[model samples]
Target chain A: MVDVVKFSGEKEKFNPNKILKTLKRAGASREQSRRILKDVESSLKDGITTKEILDRVFSGLRETPGIAAKYDLKRALMALGPGGYTFEKYFAEVLKHYGYEVKINQLIKGKRIMQEVDVVAKKDSTYMVECKYYNYPGNYASTKEAMYTYARFLDTNSRMHNFDFPWLATNTKCSWSAIEYSKGVGLKITSWKYPAKESLQRLVEAKKLYPVTVLKTASKFVKQRLLDSGIIMINTLMEMDISELRRKANLSESELKKAILEARQISV
Target chain B: MVDVVKFSGEKEKFNPNKILKTLKRAGASREQSRRILKDVESSLKDGITTKEILDRVFSGLRETPGIAAKYDLKRALMALGPGGYTFEKYFAEVLKHYGYEVKINQLIKGKRIMQEVDVVAKKDSTYMVECKYYNYPGNYASTKEAMYTYARFLDTNSRMHNFDFPWLATNTKCSWSAIEYSKGVGLKITSWKYPAKESLQRLVEAKKLYPVTVLKTASKFVKQRLLDSGIIMINTLMEMDISELRRKANLSESELKKAILEARQISV
Candidate 1:
C-alpha cells in the first residue's frame, strides 16, 4: 500500500484494486486489468497526487483511447467544448437519451421581449433548460445564473403558458448560495457535482452517451468532421457503415478503423 | 446650421442653445458660453458628431477644468472609474445626498451565506443596493444581474429582516429585459436611463454631486491622492481651508490653487 495525495491535498492509502476496477469497467479483460494495475502500482510513488496516479492509468491505456479518454470525466467534458462536440448539441442529445423530447435554441415570445431558450425538454412536464458551458473548468454557475434562468422561466411561462419549471444545467459546479437559492425558488439545477444522483457527469457515464470526441483516437479534425456530419454521439457513429463513415467524415481507412475499434470498446 | 449626429446615430440640426445651457449650468458666464460656441460653430463641419462638438467645448474650457469637466456627465462618470474615484464610495455618497443614510459594503449574515451588500441605505424603508460599475460604458446590466441581485435581496432579507427592499444601481444603461424583470420582481433599479424620473444620471445631475475626479484640472495622480486622503466630494474640498487641504492632500501650491479655483467654480 502506498500513501497518495489527492487533488484536494488530502492523503489517502492508494488502493490498487481501484485501478483494476476502472480498467475492467472500461471493457478490459480480467487478466488485462490485473496487468495494467500491476504496471500502475509498480510506478506509483508515495506522496504522489491522485491526479498523477490517474495520469499513469491514462498513459498505461493510451493505446486504448476509449478507456483512457473516459478516465477524466471532467476533462472529457472540457474536451467536448473546444474539440467541436458543441456542448449545446451534446446536452440536447443527453436529454433525448433520457427520454425527453428535446429542442435546441427555441425562440419563444415573452411578455417583455423575445427569448431564446438553450434547450427545451419535455417529459411528464415541460422543462426549460438553460445551458451554461464554460470551455474551461473551474467556473461556477452562481446564484445570479440560477435566478436569471428562473426569471426567464417566469417571463416565458407567463406569455407562452408552456414551461412548467426551470432547469439550469452547466458543465461546472454550483456555488452554495446558487444551490440554496435554486432549491428555494423551485428551480432545478444540474452541474458537474450537484443533484448527486444525476449530474452531467453521472448522466453521461450512466448511459455511456459520450460524445464522439471522447474517443481519443479521433483527432480534432476527424471529430469536427464527424460532428459536422451529424454523427455527434458515439452510438450514432457505432451505427454508421465503415465505408459511409470514411466518406462522410473524410477519414482514411486506418483512422476510421481505429475510431471504430475505440468506439466499440467504450460502447460495449 | 450644421447637422449633428447624436451618439445613437440620430441627425439633428446643431443648436447653439444646448451648448449655452450646458456652459451656464456648469458656471460659465453667458458671454463666455457664446464666445466658446462661436469658436465651435466656425469650425463645425456638416454632419459632425455631438461628441466632437462636446470635445470642442472641452478644449475651449480646458483652462477652467471644473466647469469643463462637468460638461459630459457620462464621460465624467467614466473618468471617475479609471481615474480612481472608488465607485462604491461614490455610489454611497450619491445615496447619502438623496437622504438615504448609507453604508458602503455592509456585511450581513444571511440564511445561506455572509452577504456583502453594496451601499445599504435607509430612508423610509431600508434599501439594499448592489452596485455594478463598468469602467467603460456600453456594458448593460442584464436580466441575469437583476435576477441575481433580487435573489441576494431575498436571501439577505430572510435572515437580517432589517432590509425592506432591494435596489440595483448600475453606472450604465440596462437591458430592456433587465428593466422589465427587475420591475416585475418589485426590485427598484436605477441605471443611466431607467426610471425616467430618477435615473442614475438624473440623480447625479439633480444635485451637483460630482466626484472630485470630475475636476479635469486634477491629473490622475492628483485625483488618486485626493481620493486616498478621503476627499471624495468637491464640497469637501470647498469646506477645507487652503492650508489644511494642502497638508492633507500633499498638493503643491500651484496644484492646490488650481484645484481650489475649479472647486469654487463648480461649487458656487
Candidate 2:
C-alpha cells in the first residue's frame, strides 16, 4: 500500500487501488473491499478522513439527479453506529451554505449540550432543529419525545431562551400516529421526505439561500480563555456581566473584558 | 383502603389508599395515583415497601390476562426512566419466571458488567443470557457492534471453551435482526420478549413436580440460599464440581462446599 499524506490541503487524485488496499487492511473481504473502494474513489480528495470518505459517498447518492429512491433513512442511520445520529451535522452544513453563524457542543453550567443548534441567524433568534431519522414504527415515539424535550429545553435556556422557530425535521416517514399526536398537541413537524418532490426542492432551495458562516471571532487571549472556561455560547457570555462570567468561568476580569471587547469588535 | 396483613409476617394489613396517598404526595398525578392504588390493591400483600409494591404491580401485569389493554407496558417502561431498564429490576423477573438464578451488577475485576447471567436453565446444558435495552434507536448500532465484538469473549471465557457443549450458552444475540435470530446459530437466543410460552410453562410445571420438602433440620440460612439458587436443578449441580463452580463464582472454598452441600440436602 502506498503511504499517503493524509491531511495536507492538496487536492489529491482518487486512486481505486489505494482505497481498496486500505479497506482490505481494515479487515474487509474481497467483495466489501472492492465495493468500498469504488464508492470512495469517486469522491476521494486530499485530507479527507475515512469518516469523510464514507459520508461523501452517501451524500453523493443524495445529490444524484433523478435518483431519489425513498429508501429507509433509519436503515441508513443504523449503519452510522449507535448514538451516531446527528441532525446538527447535516443542518450545520446546509446552514453554512446559507450564511448563518454556527456554534457546536456549546457548554453552559458545566453541561455540554449535544449541540447548540442549526443556526443563530439574523433577528437575534436561533433556529434549533431536532432531526429524526425514523426507520421502524416505534422510532417515531422517541423522536416525538425528543421534540417535546428540546422545545421545552430552549424555552427556559438562557441563550436561545426567547428564540423563535424551533424546527423539528425528520428524514424518513413519521408514523401517522406520531404525526396526529404531534398535531393534536400543537407540536410542529417538518418532513424533509414528505409532500413529494416540491417539498424537498423547497428545503434544498432553503439551504442554498441560507449558507451558514462562523461569525464568532475573539482576541487570541480571550479565545483561549473562553475555550479553557468551557463557555462556548456567546449569549451565555452576554447573559453574564463580565465580572460574573469571569468568576463563574474561572477567568480573570482582564481576560473577560478582553473577550467582551473582541466580541464587540466583531459585531461592529 | 381496608388494612390486610401482608406476607411479611407483620400484623399490619395493606391499604390501597395509603399507597395512593404516598404516590400522590410524591408528585404523582391523580391518574397515576389511581393506577398505583389499583396495582397495589390487587397484587400486593401486607408490609410491602413502596418499592416492592411497584415492582410486584408491574411484575403481576407481565402475565395478567389481557393486561395490555389495562396497562401499556411500553409507557410504564418509559416512566421508569433510563436506569430502570437495568437487570436488577425488570429483566430479573423475566429470568426468574424462566427458572434461572439472576444476579445483577456483579463486579468482576473491578468492572461491573451490568449483569452476568450464570444460567438460563439446563435443557441438557445450562445457557447464559445477556439483556440490553437501548434508550434510543441510535444506541442499537453500537450495541450491535459490541455484540459482534463478543466473538472474542465467547472464544476466551466460554465454560465450554475446552470442550464444546460441556455447556452451551450464547455470548450475545446471534444476529442483529431479531430475538429469534439464534434459531440456526447453534446457540439459542433467550430474550425477554421472545420466550416460547409452552416451553416456559413446561419447565415451570416440571420444577413444581418436585416439591422442596420444607425440611426444618437444615440450617435456615443454608436453606434460604438453596431456595434462592433454585435447587430444583440438583442433577446439573452434581455434574459440576463444587470448587470449579465456586471458582467461576469467585467464592471462597468453604462457601462453595457449604452451598453445594446445602443444595444437595434440599433436593429429594
User: Model 1 over residues A175-260: C-alpha lDDT tens digits?
Assistant: 89888878777888989878888988789889998888777766888887888887788888888898888888887889878777
Model 1: CA > 4 A from native: A1-58, A82-85, A159-162, A228-230, A241-258, B1-57, B79-85, B109-114, B159-164, B240-258
- lDDT score for candidate 2 against the true structure: 0.39
Q: For model 2, how does the per-residue alpha-carbon lDDT over A57-132 read when each residue is reduced to its tens digit?
A: 3454343211111111223232222232343454444454456566543432201123234333333556455555
Whole-model lDDT per candidate:
0.79, 0.39
Model 1, A53: alpha-carbon shift in Å?
Answer: 8.6
Off by over 4 Å in 2: A1-87, A95-104, A108-125, A133-156, A159-161, A184-187, A194-201, A205-268, B1-268
- The estimated TM-scores of all candidates read 0.79, 0.26
What TM-score would you give candidate 2 relative to the actual structure?
0.26
Q: CA lDDT of A41 in candidate 1?
A: 78
Which DockQ values do the candidates obtain, in the order shown? 0.34, 0.03
Root-mean-square deviation of Cα positions for candidate 2 versus the true structure, in angstroms: 20.6
The share of true interface contacts that also appear in candidate 2 amounts to 0.00
Number of backbone-clashing residue pairs for each candidate, in the order shown: 0, 17
